[model samples]
Target: MQRRFLVGLIGANIGKSLSPALHEDAFAAAGAQGYYHLMDLQVLQGRATLESLLVAVRTAGFAGVNVTHPVKEAVLPLLDEVSPEAREIGAVNTVVIGRDGRTAGHNTDRTGFRRAFEEVLGGKAAARQQVLLLGAGGAGRAVACALMDLGVQVLHVFDTDAARAQTFAADLQGRFGADRIRAAADLAGAAWQAAGIVNATPIGMLGYPGMAIAPELIDTRHWVADVVYTPLETQLIATARRKGCRVMTGGGMCVHQAAEAFRLFTGLEPDVARMHRLFNEACARRDAKLAAAG
Candidate 1:
């Protein structure tokens, strides 16, 4: 039997978010019909506006919602309760509102990171492997945790805000150990000569341009992944490709995370390969829109 369609929500530097397309594809793949909306609280007034939107979604019958940056942590107190990992990560990226009208929050970023990373690396990105990470905010925390779980030997974290980067490093060290974490003293000078490098920052996105790290630092020996997929053809990914590094874009994370959330909301396993196809189609559509606008 065909399932009823539902609604979903996402926010961040969402001016270029592909979530609507991704979910639209999911609904179609699952033989469920539904719509996803791109909600920008920045355009609205504040939390009040966001709360009102959430209420409206409930009234209108949204299946579930996906929360992104800025609101991932903020939406915690507003939620009925959250998953243990979401609580531990101090962030939530997916929310499912049940038939009882109760909301449950989950952090799929970490799990998504691991899934995507393993899919590319084909094994645990263990401690013996050096991993360089850009950005110390939510995505950094999620990836760092995933690396630690994989027994990664060391993590080099860098951010323009040195203090923020140091603080996140300290937290990781405190939880994991000093042996597995360190601050990037030199982004150049082979400090990033690691098995993998990741751009956890919002750089290289729509309004944002430029590589998260120096292009000179990228080489064929390192595996590169960026959490940005708006343009999808981000400078980081492009440079990595030129350097012959295996590249993973935020698109993979988007699909895997949503699939997990879909299972939570529907209690049925998602058709992941089909989800990927839908996501790619939606991305193509977005590119067409941008081209037309230009």
Candidate 2:
């Protein structure tokens, strides 16, 4: 009998995620049989309930699981061990369960972020230019560290939570140095001073509206990137494109991360081009659904 594989995403507000479709398509393209499920854990509030659900998933023979949002940090404690990257980022997005009941946590966000940055900007985004990062949460932290590894001269970080932003800034600075980091409460005052801008927040996601930063602040001289890929062409990316700024969409990061996860489970390098095509088709389907609803 052939072995069956199962994968799932655990977190709230994942109904809008394209992960299921992407993974399913990759499975088909690879001639593999498996089901990728979206598990909304918001219903299982508190640590006990979440742990119970996780324990159940492991027992049910799931190959692995993907963590997102509110659970990235929460899932850390539940795992038996974590990768150095995940530990350093203080977040985990993928969890693989061992047959002996051991769980290992890993973060693929940095790998995805770096690939997307290099693919979109070629070699122009060197380590000597300032980066105006507009979020300081899990996603933001991963991308910031990825940027530092790529030679970012400075990272000007910000978030609505001033304290959180300051803390992340200080942490990165301690590791990367004071000469390469600065935390800000907001970007309203310093938009024009950076080489590029990145949005790691949920603003401009499918159900969300508006760009995290004002459109007027974007100009032809800057490079812009957003981690929101649901609406591949987010309001921020659209506005930046209109202003002649080079823009990077989050879809690349999404596909790359999912690809790495696929490799983790299947030990095969899936066709990225095929994955990209399937993903674009899925996005189009989603857009049609949204249009019909409106």
Candidate 3:
């Protein structure tokens, strides 16, 4: 008999998320009965709350859930337990609910970012000594640690919310040491100083459509990476590539991270390559539909 698994993602402005297609494809290939649900906050309104959704998923026999955006950090205090790594990163992107209804939080973003960074841009890009990280939100928190582990001697984190950027940078500074990380209050100045850049913000994604760093700020010498894969290539990535900078799209990170999340949810190893192919195919199809509609 095929094993059954139920999993989902929780986030706002996520109707365009490729996660359902990616995971369902993986499950089918693995010969397992699976349902990948989307608990989008945009569509939910008052129909449900984050706290209520967790309880519902646990009671409804869900294997786990992936949290994103505004909720990743918010979900931390709510989980029954959190991995030390997730705790240290100060965010939780993945949560596994036990059969006994106890929920445990984990973070695959760190390893996922590192693996994807190495895969797409190579280790040479990560050791740039200094990198500008846009957004100090949930994803940024994970990517920040990844950059540090990958040998980034200095990381300048920036967020539209100055306080968030400062607080997050301070937290990371304590762990990685004050000399390595700090909030980049001057976006323009930091862009000039950093050798490479990583965009962990949602700004360049489908719904949020704009470059986090202005086009003028991107230089030919800098390398760039983004965490938004829905459009496949974000504006920042496209701009950087045009400027002759080495670039990486969020697709690789999304695939590698989802591969880890799939394993945690189903105890099955997902074919990362297969997921990558599916992701591209799905994005192409989605773009085609949008183009046709217009």
Candidate 4:
């Protein structure tokens, strides 16, 4: 009998996510049957919450689910166990369901972001320059750790919520040191002081259609990276590119994280090369569809 697994992704504004296609192809290549469901918060808004969806998926015998966006940090308390790394980062991107129905959460975002940064930027985040990070939320936490691990000398964290940014910086200070990690009070001021900018927030994605930082603030010398993949070339990425700045799309992190999540869900090694190939194809298709719609 062929092995079968049911998994899901829970997030908002994810109607365009290609994770379902990627996972299905992976399962077929490995001779297993898989069903990947998308539980878009945009669709389930009033009907369900992250807490309820976690319970629902678990009760329905789901293998696991990938948590994203606003809920990555919110899902932590709902899990029976969270990996030490995730506990430290205060976010969970992947969860593994045990045979006993116990759920354990882990973070693949940190690994995924790190690998992507090394590949795309050749580890430029480690250039020993002061870096500015926007959005000190779930994804931001993972990116912050990855940046530090890559030898980033100093990191300034900023968010629309001033207190949240300050709190996140305070939490990371114990591990990475207060001198290296700081809460940025001024957006333009932080950008002026940093060498690179990382948007860990959802601002550049589809429904959230605006660059976190202004265009004029991004100079040609500043390298920029955004964690929004839907429109591969987000406004931030495009702005950085036009200024001749090195840039990274969220696609790398998306595919790499999906690969890690697949391994955790099915205990199967993922063909990362295949994922990259499919991801590019999917993006091309998405672009074409958008063009046609217009």
Give the whole-model CA lDDT for all candidates, comma-separated. 0.78, 0.84, 0.91, 0.91
| RMSD of candidate 4 to true structure, Å | 1.2
Comparing 2 and 4 by lDDT, which wins? 4
- lDDT digits (tens) for residues 44-66 of candidate 3: 98899999999999999999999
RMSD of each: 2.6, 2.0, 1.2, 1.2
For residues 1-294, write the lDDT of model 2, one tens digit per residue.
434678888977778789988887777778787798887765555644557768977888887889887678888898899999899988888888777768888888999889888998864674688889988888898899889878888788989898999999888887789989899755865577788999998898876778888888887998999988878889999999999989999988998889988887666568898888888888888878876886
Residues 1-294 of candidate 4: C-alpha lDDT, one tens digit per residue: 999999989998889999998898888878899999999998999999998888889899999999888799888888999999999899999989887789999999999999999999888556688999999999999999999988998899999999999899999999989899999998889899998999998997877888999999999988899889888989899999999999999999998999999999999988899889999999999968976884
Evaluated against the true structure, the overall lDDT of model 3 is: 0.91
TM-score of each prediction: 0.88, 0.93, 0.97, 0.97
Better of 1 and 4 by TM-score: 4
Worst 10 residues of 4 by lDDT: 121-130
Clash pairs, model 2 backbone: 127-151, 127-152
Q: Which residues of candidate 3, in runs, are more than 4 Å off? A: none
**lDDT score of model 1?**
0.78
Model 2 regions lying over 4 Å from their true place: 42-49
Arranged by lDDT with the best first, the candidates are 4, 3, 2, 1
